[model samples]
Target: MFASGLCFVGVTGIVRYLGTELPAVQSAFLRFAWGVVFLLPALIGVLRSGMPGLHLRLHLGRGVVHVAAVVCWFYAMARIPVAEVTAIGYLNPVLLTLGTVVFFGERLSLRRVLAIGVALTGALIVLRPGLREVTDGHIAQIFAAVFFAGSYLFAKRLSGIASAGQIVAMLSLVVTLALAPLAAWVWVPVSAEQIAWLAVVAACATGGHYCMSRAFAAAPIAVSQPVVFLQLIWAALLGWVAFGEAVDVFVLLGGAVIVGSVSYITWAEARQRRRVVMPEVL
Candidate 1:
């Protein structure tokens, strides 16, 4: 989890360094294009296994949501401070919790509800939509978070029928195909330096997901959930050292509150899992 967090921070730093010189959509496509290179081994593995049949539509849907999310995220990373972007991304899990309740018909306990409320309050503080003029980057992050939540939800559904590697491979293929045209449409001349940065972003993103999967396998979700909070700290430090961005007090306080809420929600989820029934012994 720690490695995943660090890799993700590195990816964000690279994206921020790239800035808005290229269109966000084109930059997002390049990120995925380069990332597909890292997934080639996993793609071969899935093909050799052939256990789960590929669901092209499901993968395509996930890719669509992911493309939108990636575009927004890249845009936000380019225009906003990395720490702020990372802080706003806390909303993804919050939305996922609510989504399960609404879309999956999962029961939401009072504690879970209260926790969600607190997390949203933190988001409001970070966004400060009331006082500050919400820029396009801020709006992008908001929508991107929602799309990311949707992408995760779809991934969870796919996981029921497919191995993680298979799902990831399919997602990569679909994303590459979907974004290829966009990359061509708004293509810009790329220098070797930019290519190097994109390669780093790709490597970090692929490695981050791999590490996250390993973390989940190593520990229960309850244990792993808290590790994600470390990402905000890492992001803040990277943003400061790399970009001279300062962390705001409100973002810290709000992020803490949001983390607390998410921790509570994770505990609740584990408790619910413990209560699930099993078939009688034969």
Candidate 2:
């Protein structure tokens, strides 16, 4: 989890450094392309294994959502402070909880509902929508969170039928296919420095996802979820040291509240799982 957080922070630093010089779509494609290269060994395994049984349509659907989310994220990161982007990204879990209730027919307990509300309050504090005018980056971050949540829901479904390596391979392939045309259309000449940064971003992102997958496999979500809070700290430090961006008090406070809410939700889920599993023993 610590490694995952650090890798993610490094990726964010690279993205912020690149800024909007490259179109968001093109940057996303480049990042994913580099990610695919990093995962070439796994791809080779998938090929040798003759393709893992997977729902192609579902994978493609997830790919679309993920691509959109990545584009929005790039736009947001280019415009906002890295810490702010990281803080705002916490809203993805809130959105994911709502999505599960609405679309997956998952029962929402009062505790979970309260957690969602608290998390939203934290988001509002971070954005301060009415007090200060919201920037396009703020809106983009919110939309990115929503789409990321959608992608995660699809990923959860996919996990039931596919191995982690298979899912990662399919996502890379589908995203490549989906974004290749736009990437070509928006192709702008990039300097060697930009290429190097993009490569670093891709490598870090791949490592981040790899660590995340390993963490999830090692422990239940309840145990692993709290570790994600570390990312905000890493992001803040990276932003400050790398870009001289100051971390605001409100961002820190709101992020803490959001993290607390998510921790409660994780505990609730774990408790619920225990209830279900212990009944057979009883």
Candidate 3:
């Protein structure tokens, strides 16, 4: 999971640099399309299974939302400081909980409500809306997280019916196709250097997901997820050392709060899952 965290930072760092030379939508499209190219071997068998067995609706739904998330994320990466982008990305799981309540009719328990509030409070601290004007980049990242939450919800809906590999593969392929039109519409000249960098982004992003999947399969998500906060530290450090962006103490404090809330939520969900698996004592 630590490795995964670093890989994600690498991915975002590359995206940030490459965003200077290409449109966010096109860069994102290339990332997915390149991911599909690299993942072709793993995807081949799933592809052979035909459209009916692939759960096309869920894949398409996730792909659409994921494309939006990626585009917004890329846009945010270009316009905002990497640390700010990383800090705002923490809203994903919080938003995911809200998405479940809205779309799946899940009950909003008190714990969840508080967790949501804590997370949002953290975001408020980071943004300080009254004191500072929120940039378009900040708003873009928030939107990115919302659509990412939607994508995550769709993935959950598909979990029972598909294998992990299939889920991962379908996301890349479907999202690549979904992003095609946008890429074409806003097409621009991309140099080999830019392509090489986006390729690195593809590798890091995909590799990070693979590492996280392995960690999740090895243990309950509750155990592995907390380590994800390490990414914020790494992102802050990377921003400072690599990009010369100063770390804001408030961003650190807010991110810590957000991570704490999200970590508690993960532990709670894992406990619930264990309860479902274990028989009652009577």
Candidate 4:
């Protein structure tokens, strides 16, 4: 998970460096296009598997939702400080928790509800909308978090029936196809340098997903999720050193609060799962 965090931070840094030179849709499209190249083997497997009709539709739906999230994220990363974007992204797990309750009928305990409240408080601290001018970037990131949470809900549903590789490969293929029209509509000429950097983004993002999957397989979420908190710290340092962006204490503090809340929720969930399984073991 540490390696996964670093890889994601690298993606954030590269996207921020790219700035708004390319349209967000086009940039997002290219990143996944390049990612498709890296995931071709998995794609081939998915193709040969002859996925069920419903499953294919779910994959397409997830891809479309993910495109929204990625475009919003790219736009936010270009315009906002990396740390702020990273901090806002912590909202995904919070939203995801709520989504599972609503969509999957998961039991939402009082502790989880309180954690959700605290997470929202952390987001408010980071934004401080009335106090600071809330830019479009901030709004975009919030939308991104919501869309990402939705995408995760899709993934959670798909996970019961599909291999991780199939899900990743299908998302890359489907998102690239979905973004093609939007990207071409607003496409601007991208230099080779920009393409190279976007390729890096693809590599880092793909690598991060791979590392995160391995991390999950290796250990429980309670053990792995906390390590992801380092992503905010790394983003802050990268923004400061690479882009000369001033470190915002509020962003860091809010991010820490969110992470702590998320960690608590993850630990609680793991404990609950263990308890449920223990009776069977006995």
Candidate 5:
């Protein structure tokens, strides 16, 4: 998980360095297109083994939403400080909880409600709309979080029916295909240097997802999720040293609040699952 965080920081830093010289859609497309290269073995394995109960529609839907998320993420990273982008992204799990309740018939417990409220408050602190200028970057990242939440919800549904490798591979291919037209629409003359940097972005992102999957498979999410906060810290320091972006205490504070809220909710859910299973065992 720590490695995953570092890889994420690498991705963010490169995107920050790349700036908006390339269009967001084109940049995103290149990343995923390169991602497909790294993940080709997995894709081939799925092709050969053949998934018996594959949900093609769900994969396509997830790819569509994921394209939106990546485009927004790239757009925001180019325009905003890395730390701010990372901090705002912590809203994803909170939004995922809401999505689950609405789409999966999950009960919205009071604990969840309180957690969501606190998470939103944390977001407000980070944005502080009235206190500071909320740029298009901020709005773009928020929308990215929403789309990412939707993507995760799709993953949740697909998890029961698909292997993690299959899901990841399918997502890469589908997203690459979906992004093609959009990328072409706004495409500009990308230099070789830009392509190389985007290739780095792709490698880091793919490695990060792999590390995250291994971490989760090795330990419970409640144990691994907390380590994610380190990404915000790393992003802050990286932005400060690399880009000379000022480190905002409020961003760290708000990020902590959001991480704490999410962690508490995760713990609560884990405990609830144990309770349900204990009765069945008894």
Candidate 6:
């Protein structure tokens, strides 16, 4: 997952660079569009073998929410510092944990309750509400995190019925189709250079997900989860070097707390899963 996290840093850099040149909606659309294009061959094969998963509507619904989330994310990237964007993104997993209890009827343990509380505290530290006026970008990122939490909740629902690759392929196809109209409506002509940049974006996204899947397969979530913190560090470095942005100490401290909470959540989850499976093993 370390490599995956690094690849995502590259994705953030490209989106931030193009954020100035392209409309956020269009830029978000192009990234997923190219991702779909690159995955077409594999997707075609998956389809040829007979669509593997049930609940066609569920997959499409995920795509719709993902489109909104990604559009919001692109807008935030354009206006906010990358570190701030990364810091705010740490909320997604926490929100996702809460979402399960609310939407899916999953029980929230004491550990989860504490983790959620800490995550919110970390968010407050990061935002420091009265100290700095929360801008549109901050609001957008919050919305994006909520929607992304929803999207991930859907993914978890589908995991029992489908393979990870199948789920991802379906999402890429659906999200691409979902974005096509918006992209067309707001379409502005772009240079081949822009196309090249978006292609790189697609490649990193695709590769990052693939690497993440491999990481998950290779170890328990608790073991691999902390490696994701490297992404924040990388984003900070990229922001400093490429965009001439300064690191915000609050963002760093807040991100560490958020990451710690997320790690605890994942560790707890892994332990729960093992407890559920131990009887079968015996």
Query: How much lDDT does each candidate structure score?
Result: 0.85, 0.88, 0.89, 0.94, 0.94, 0.88
Candidate 2 stretches with Cα past 4 Å from truth are: 45-54, 279-282
Q: Give the TM-score of each candidate.
A: 0.92, 0.93, 0.95, 0.97, 0.96, 0.94
Query: What's the CA RMSD for each of the models?
Result: 2.6, 2.0, 1.6, 1.3, 1.7, 2.2
For the record, the alpha-carbon RMSD of candidate 3 to the native fold, in angstroms, is: 1.6
Candidate 4 lDDT tens digits, 7-40: 9999999999999889999999999999999999
| Model 3, C-alpha of 94: deviation from truth (Å) | 0.6
- Please count the clashing residue pairs in each candidate, in the order shown: 0, 0, 0, 0, 0, 0
Across 51-76, the per-residue lDDT of candidate 1 in tens digits comes to: 53356567778999998888889889
Model 2 agreement with the true structure over 1-282: per-residue lDDT tens digits: 889989999988889988889999888888888878878898888767764345777888999999999989999999999999999999998899899899889999899889999999999888887788889998999999999999999998988887888889879878877889988998999788887789899888888888987998999888888888889988888888989999887888888889889988898888978898885654
> Which residue window of length 10 is worst by lDDT in model 5?
46-55
The TM-score that candidate 1 achieves is 0.92
Clashes counted in candidate 5 amount to: 0
Tell me the tens digit of each residue's lDDT in model 3 across 59-165.
99899999999999999999887878888999999999998999999999999999999999999988889898899999999999999999999999898888888
Poorest stretch of ten by lDDT in candidate 4: 273-282
The C-alpha stretches of model 4 lying farther than 4 A from their native spots are 280-282
Off by over 4 Å in 5: 48-54, 279-282
lDDT (Cα, 0-100) at 266 in candidate 3: 86
